[model samples]
Target chain A: MHTTLAWIDYLIMVIYFAFVLGIGFALKRFMKTSTDFFLSGRSIPAWVAGLAFISANLGAQEVIGMAASGAKYGISTAHFYWLGAIPAMVFVGLFMMPFYYGSRARSVPEYLRLRFDEKTRGLNAISFAAMTIFSSGASMYAMAKLIGVLHIFDPVVHALGLPTGYVFHLSILVSAVITLGYVYLGGLTSAIYNEVLQFFLIVAGFFPLVWLGLKNVGGWEGLIAKCPPGFGHAWKGMTNADTNPLGVEWFALAMGLGFVLSFGYWCTDFLVVQRAMAADSMTSARRTPLIAALPKMAFPFLVILPGLIAVALPTPTAVEAPTSASASVVEADALGHGLIPAKVKTDGSIERDSAGQPVLDYDLAIPKLLLHYFPAGLLGLGLTALLASFMSGMAGNITAFNTVWTFDIYQAYIKPEASDKHYLRMGHFATLFGTAISIAAAYVVASYNNIMELLQLVFAFVNAPLLGTFLLGMFWKRATANGAFFGLLSGIGAAAVHHGVSLPAGSVPGVKGAWINRGAEFVANLAGWSPRLPFHAYRNEMAQNFWTAIWAFGVCFVVTIVVSLATKPRPDEELKGLVYSLTKHDVEHGLPWYRKPEVLGVAVVLMSIALNVIFR
Target chain B: MNLDIRVPIGLLFLSLGGLLTGYGVVTHFTSPEIYAQSLDVNVNFWWGLAMLAFGAGMLHYGRRAVARSTAAVGAE
Candidate 1:
């Protein structure tokens, strides 16, 4: 039977969206000033902020992408969620939040200003805003594509009699319109409430699916009976670069870059920090990110379990013959072994595709599993959860984008003295504008090979530098303003050049004519670039995340300190403010770094090591 | 604000969430057969209904707590 969604499902979704809109209208009374719109009048409790933070980050890319990764890479891919993120989040909660909240800075970029100067803050803010817009667009497009696959909006598409692919675009536009409406009305408050709802729905959706998937695989023993080689294990012991599933050296590179990537996204990404900064009090703000941290630790099971279970089922009859090397591996296992691996004999062999390109289709694994398993009414809730994730993320990004533009860019630059009413209006307008830009960008980026890989590449270019700027601001006292500005720019510029020129897949050095060209191609959608390099290549996109982050922070810290020392400290008043001393001093008589940093540091190191071992 | 009640209760919820998750995972890995049959429609529906109820309850509880805290602060 066709997976037809009944009317009740639609009603449930409508009610859900209506509730979100209700929250927006409810919060409207509080939006007397721009501060309320942007920061929720700083009245959010730790628990709410915490839930919202997790929900915001656990968006479309995460739900679909994490599931996909599990299908492709096996359970070891859980490293991306659990090992890579938990430490960074804990670090942010324990150490970074105090400084960020204490600084009384509006945006993450604003903290850069207090720690350094305006120029640094302005540059970092612009970069972060750009990154958020691009990432948000990519997420929105992916979500639409997923919903279209589920045939959720077929009635609308059929009425219009549009092309098959047209439904995807339409779904995205519909989502954009609804998300933009809520964000524009309630700002951060609306986004937070929506996210909390979305998080619960997501959990409810996935937990049941995991249950169904495991049951299909004949319980744990049956699943273990079907376990392909490299199934439970982190690293398959092959050393050859071509033969290695995830690559021999990539373990280090992935773990290192993963740390850098997580720290940047969780610690510094605007959509995340914007929630933290909106907490009602300092203690709440400090606790919020940490509260979110616990949920994040449990995310792997939700995202990865579906993919692992997919391996146990008989292959679909309509599926095309194995084309990719990885497909061959799956095929081999299915034929000879009873749902077991061909390459390795044991239960836990490093799960990799046959040709060594990490499994790209794993992102599709979770959704495909849902299609295979969940029937009818329950399926509607599952689909709703997925949609909820996408909307929550888009809402979070749009809300943050609006705040940054209105406060940091528009007000700081164009309309400084605008009243609260004018600012709120501008905030709504900014949300609309941001959504429009993101939609356009999403249309361009979605066609490239793997959504998960593309996300990593984007993070490398955009977030690496932000991480650098934030790191220097937090730890290094000597960092100078000019140093930070120059360092930040140089780091991004360098990463682009590294990605663009040096690191395309299979490129030959010095033999330039008709050489292999594989790297991220943002400009391809434009008139100039598509024919020559129509899509961005993964370059076996090794851990540029780790190095770029170092360069960004290293350069900025050195530059900021050298420049500040050489020029002069920004008159003692600005330098000696409570913000500057916040990280260094514990006015509230809390535990200081010399005493408590050990536990946090040890935990971070242990997490990094565990991730490394898994990758290995 | 007096955080002793809030802090412990919050921690309890967090811990329980973690414990349930861990138990769910172990059950998933150890016994897949239990989950595969058409999801127990009764169980699934009831669980959803229960969560919906719980979520609504939490919303009410949170509102009351918030209101009471605000009043207490005002009185002081």
Candidate 2:
């Protein structure tokens, strides 16, 4: 398809990229020490950290992924934003953040060490870093693909004479490089500052698409006219097979995964956890995440609903659905039929219908809507929001990567006696290394069926094990080092086994029929040769994914707690130290009346009960 | 987070239902040709109102929370 962006639009994107780089360069002075680079020297105000944390979480992939799901899954897909994210944020704000901030740790891994043992902390840090690389890399590739589709960097691809197949990798490489350059130069301060700017734009950009799409689809009426029966219903025709909004298994999985994943992400993920750790006071840090929760409650409309509107509007004839990676958006009607639809592959090839006509790529829903519907200046602003979302997220992850590697791994293990200045330099070096690894990993990503599925798979294994170990240590005093280590390994092992075994036999619960099966006989026939196998693989992989891992977390947590009970407790001092991490009090210093363990414990329980109702 | 300026979030809700009602009235009087083309306008009026209501609800809750917190602080 021909490019939709005019030369001016291209120039605007270039200027945006340059501005981000300039911001990185400008903030270098603030990043003098390891503390400064890692956590913005722990001076970030609550609001900035709040916005940056939210911005960082809503990366390009999430915006597009949620939109794509909205197009394909309709209102049912909103559960991910509402059920999965919002509640999780509330949990983090009220419960998880207190634990994170009170611990007074540099990173989540450090918290793990205080809560569990040295071995678990080190292992979790490494696992988390690796997981971040996969997630951040996928996000980079997705963002790059979107930019390429929008023609922001199409000329560079043409000039390089690279195959269209390489565009995904090229996109990942460019995004990662830019992200790394800024993060390496400045670190968390630049990331947070830039995020605050990006958040407003991202919200503003969404309005035009939604307004226009609503207008074009004949307003809300036109959308309703175009939609199939029960399409607009938030439940999307899901019933007893799913007792709740999601099926029983899915609900269990959603809640279970929601519990484990949210706790892990809010409590342990360095990218977010470090934000709270950077606060000026324990209360500010504890409250920042909750303050951020307000935004989480409403973000899905700005990001996801536009794609749903895209489904109501006419599909663009110009673009074709690329592979699963390329097709982040889909038609709401086609998706309701339970068919994934023929999308553009990474190779930029299209499949044909029964009459041999080319299929429309559903992923172009948002872009096509933007091109045809949006006016000139608004278009540029919208694109900026998109770009900002990508950059802020990638930048934050990259900074977190550098901080964890430099402090937790390099300074702690590789060069224990390194000076602060030397370690700060090492932090910069690690940012470069992380970028390189992510770019390399992006190449293998194309072979994977679905980018989001792939991310959840890795995150499940990485997060579940760590979440189990930490939960045990925090709540159960009897949890010993041996139990923590073994429990962590066992949780990961269970998830890995479930992920592996569920595939190949057609048993994965949420895996839909392949895209090839969605088209007319002609495409369906082709789906036989290349087969629906690829798309099926993606479906199966995502089926029972995070939920499965949540179950694993629960099982491992129980086993560890039980096993620890049978074993002897550690010395009083050791136990007291573990307890102190949760209370943010010194061991030798007696607690004040308000700081009494019983008071805090009751507050925690009451908060959890309130959250349970709010989430439900 | 405390705010003295107050805007009734209920206005957002009134606009939602009000917009759709106005559109429905306008469409009723339009020519047949225009009416067919204007169906989308009608839908937008309705859904937009829904959105307006939701947004208004959020504003109301936010305002209430702020008020309560402020009251607590004042009492203290």
Candidate 3:
């Protein structure tokens, strides 16, 4: 079924776009220097920065992917938010923010240079720059694909006399232009401001959808009753890999995802950290991620609940089926028991079976909910919220890209003696360059079938080992620069080796597989050996990703410690403010009970534990 | 902090909230057919009211802070 939006929806979207652009233009005067452009002069309030911090990470994949996981794996997916995110966010707020905000570094890699050495910074900067571009492209691709599948702009395209096929290309161009325009005009300030706005819009948009869906499904008790066995509880079937929808054991879930991947993304990734670092004061900076954790903890109800609700709803199936007992058995087997099965055509239409029943596509759960429940005015707001999320994610990447390029790479390597004005100009130009590259990356992602899976693989390759390097660099005063640099390299090498050996059959199709296999063969030949490795298949790609990160973190941690002990350590004076032990302990005794980070941190942790217990 | 982003954001949300609230009120007496999809919840009305309250709070705090900052500048 094709869902078409009303004119009021279009008007609402236009108004949202106008406000976004107006904010960008309005903030342009504030960008008189590089600091203002890149870091908002470190003057944003905790609430605003906190909202933006979470919004930057809430891209198209996050919203759509979370709902999709909810439908497929049930509440087990809440592990991502509870075990995977909350603890890591709290750890960053309470322990790591002091160094990040105190070191006076402009970017995460800049922090590395202060703590470790130039080579470590360069390695991180180059990889981080590349990763952000790819991530931006992935967001663009997901937005375009979602728009096309949902037929969100079909009415506009038809009214404009444009072919329906141009919808994908149009979605990409419009999002790219809008993001580039705002980010170019106002820099990180604009991005943060819009991210806050997007955060509110997302909550406003999805709140009604979840409410309406729950009401239709007869509320929480109804949902539990309708869903299959083991669907309501988070930890019921988590004892063994084969018993659960996630098909992964609790040990791996806790250690691999909860500890490794979560910390890697939350602590080390500059996309989220940049928002926290832009806070007005050290106290605000420390509290930014903590404030974000409040909403982060509660987000599953908004995004994931729809998926569970969709599963409880009756599956749309073909209208007619064979009446014979043998035919009924075959149909039942083909439908995969209780799972929703849709007969999707090449043209994106859902075809009715012989029984004339409409089939359901689980990926369309959220959009279907929106289309079914919202009226003209609210529908427009919902679409605008989606568009806002996509733009915020893209802007987040572009801003980070420009800052790292201008500060870490260009200023540090290309020309060390450039004026402040010259660096500021470079930042502007880098925004354009980053947007263009992201547009290209979006096209590359379009060629892939699953954007989220591809992104997870990319995260595994880059973030896991990087987190290891940061973990040791921050807490361990004895970690030498040489150890950090080499450990990072070996850690990444371990990740690649693990992936190459354990690659599932038919995971990479056609040209990509050929290229990867050729590279592997060349490496094997160089080492005077054949390219035969043991095949360790995983239950799913997510399991593989968790193991990849686990192995990478292990390698980096062991190697960094071994190498650090072998090499001379930096002086205590030189390590001041950069190392935890060397830094002074200045307690904020004047602050009230609620304002303190420790109090807030404990409260957030307690809330997360409460959620885990309830859900589990 | 210098610009007080709350003012502009507050203005935008307030306008949108007013528009949605007005629509909701107009349709409330007539019982519009479109709201049938939302299980007759009138989500627009309730959410609009919520947004209105939030926007008014933001504007209140934002304007007061702006005035305070201006007064401090005059004293200096």
Candidate 4:
């Protein structure tokens, strides 16, 4: 069914868009230098930066993807925030923030150059730049696709005689222009300030959705009563892989997601780190992630509750799948699942699960519930929240891309001797360039979706290895440039090789791995004589992803240590601010106990653990 | 640093809340049927009012901050 919007909805959207542009327009005059444009002149408050840090990552993927996972896996998805992000954010705040803030590196890759060698920095900067653009574009594609599917603007567009197909193109164009307009005019300050606004707007929008939804579904306990056993529990069935919907046991979950992947994304990725780096002072910088953790740990409730409510509501009359599910509407209704429509293919045929029942389009969980529960006025706010998420996500990438390009790539290599003014001009040029390419990439994603998957897998291989390099480089002063460079390469190689050999169960070769030997049987044959060498396929793609990261981290960690021992160390004086042992931790003696990173870190961790226990 | 970001955020929310609350009030008086999808509750009225209060709070804090900064500058 086409979900049409009333004039009130249109008015809400117009107000939101106006505020976004006006903020950018307001900030344009203060963007006097590259530092202001790129780093917010190191003047943003801790709370603001903290909010931006989380908001920058809150793309369509995080909101929609988490909701989707919540529908399919139940409360198990909370592990992503509670077990995954909380510890990592706290770690970054209490441990890694000192080096990042103290080093005065303009970007994450620049920090690599200061700690590691040039080649390592180059490899990181290029891959990271490409990854950010692609992901930004992919999110753009998803948002546009969702807008088309919702058909919320169909009334106005159709009245204008606009064809249905152009909805995707119109959505993409509108988002791209607004994103470019803000980032181009005011730079990172604009992006960060707007990210803060987006954060609040998203809460303003989705919070009520969750509230209204829970009331309808009889609150948390009532919803849990309708679900299967362990559906509301976070740690249940986590002892083994097959018992849990996540398809990975507790050990793998802790080591892979909690330790390696979380640290990799939060600590190393420039998108979130940039926010911390923009803070006004070292203390604020360190506190960025710590403050962010407060909202982050509770985010699952806002993003995931709609799905739980959707699944728990007594099954409504089944809305038949787009075209071919007409024959099985009764069958779908009999399954006692409702609201979530079936996933359909390009040919409009219903996609089926292994049991031959229609597979729900879980990504539509949030959208469907919003339409079901919200009236015209609130519907506008909810849709605006979604649109804000997509734009902020894209803007985050654009800002990061321009900074890395201008600082790491242009000044470092292209023209080593240029006035600061020239470089500032280059940053503007880079913003235009990055946004243009991202728009092009969005079109590419619309055509061949596999490129996004392939890019994501590439990102997994790339990002997973870097945390090992950073850990060794910062903690082990002996980690030489050669060691870091080769160790990183070897880590990436090990990740690729492991993925190339072991496939996820029931999946064919290609994006899901096992492209090399097609099975673990072949790899196991090399050490087949020993029972311990019996390697089998992973339970799912996530299981494979976690293991791949583990292999990469392990190899990179060991190789970096060995190579560092063999190679000459960078002198202690050279490593002063960058290395943990060499650097002096700034004493915040004047601050009260509650203001300390240690205090905040402990508080955040305990709160997250409390959540796990409560949910468990 | 450029400008207090909270000021703009406050203004945006204030206007948004006003529009929503106005619409909600109109519908509350003229036609309550608009809230049927929302389980017979006037979400627009309630949530809009909540937003307006939040916006007002933010603006109050933001203005105080600006005033305090200016006063400190004058004292210096």
* Highest DockQ scorer: 4
Give the higher-TM-score candidate: 1 or 4: 4
Writing each residue's lDDT as its tens digit, candidate 4 over A1-616 gives 2257888888899899998999889999998888988999999999999999999999876888788778877898898899988999999998999999999999999999999889999989988899888888888888988887676765567787988778888888899899999999999999999999999999999999888888877888888987756779889999999899888999989998888888898989999999999999999999999999999998999997777887876665545333432444334433436566665555556667576877666677788888778888889999999999999889999999999999989998899889888988999999988988988888887432222234335556988899999999888888999899889999999999888877777666655676675344556667664222323589877788888888899999999889889988877888899999988887988999999989999999999999999998
- After TM-score superposition, the amount by which residue A44's alpha carbon in candidate 4 deviates from its true location, in angstroms, is 0.6
Off by over 4 Å in 3: A317-362, A447-450, A503-534, B26-31
- Return the lDDT, model 2, position A352: 50
Give the alpha carbon lDDT tens digit for every residue of A395-503 in model 1: 8888878888887788878888978899889988898899999999888774443566677767767777667667766665555677677777776776665554443
**Would you list the rank order by lDDT, best first?**
4, 3, 1, 2
lDDT of 3 by residue, A424-521 (tens): 99999999999999999888874433345567677777888988898899888999999999999998988887776665433542222233455666
Highest-scoring model, lDDT: 4
Ten-residue region with minimum lDDT total, candidate 3 chain A: A321-330
For model 2, state the Cα shift of residue A265 in Å: 2.6
lDDT of 4 by residue, B1-76 (tens): 5377788888888988888888888999898987877889988988888999999888889888888888888899
DockQ of each candidate's interface versus the true one?
Answer: 0.13, 0.04, 0.57, 0.73
Q: Best to worst by TM-score, what's the order?
A: 4, 3, 1, 2
Question: Could you say which candidate leads in TM-score?
Answer: 4
CAPRI-style quality class for the chain A–B interface of candidate 2: incorrect
lDDT of 1: 0.65
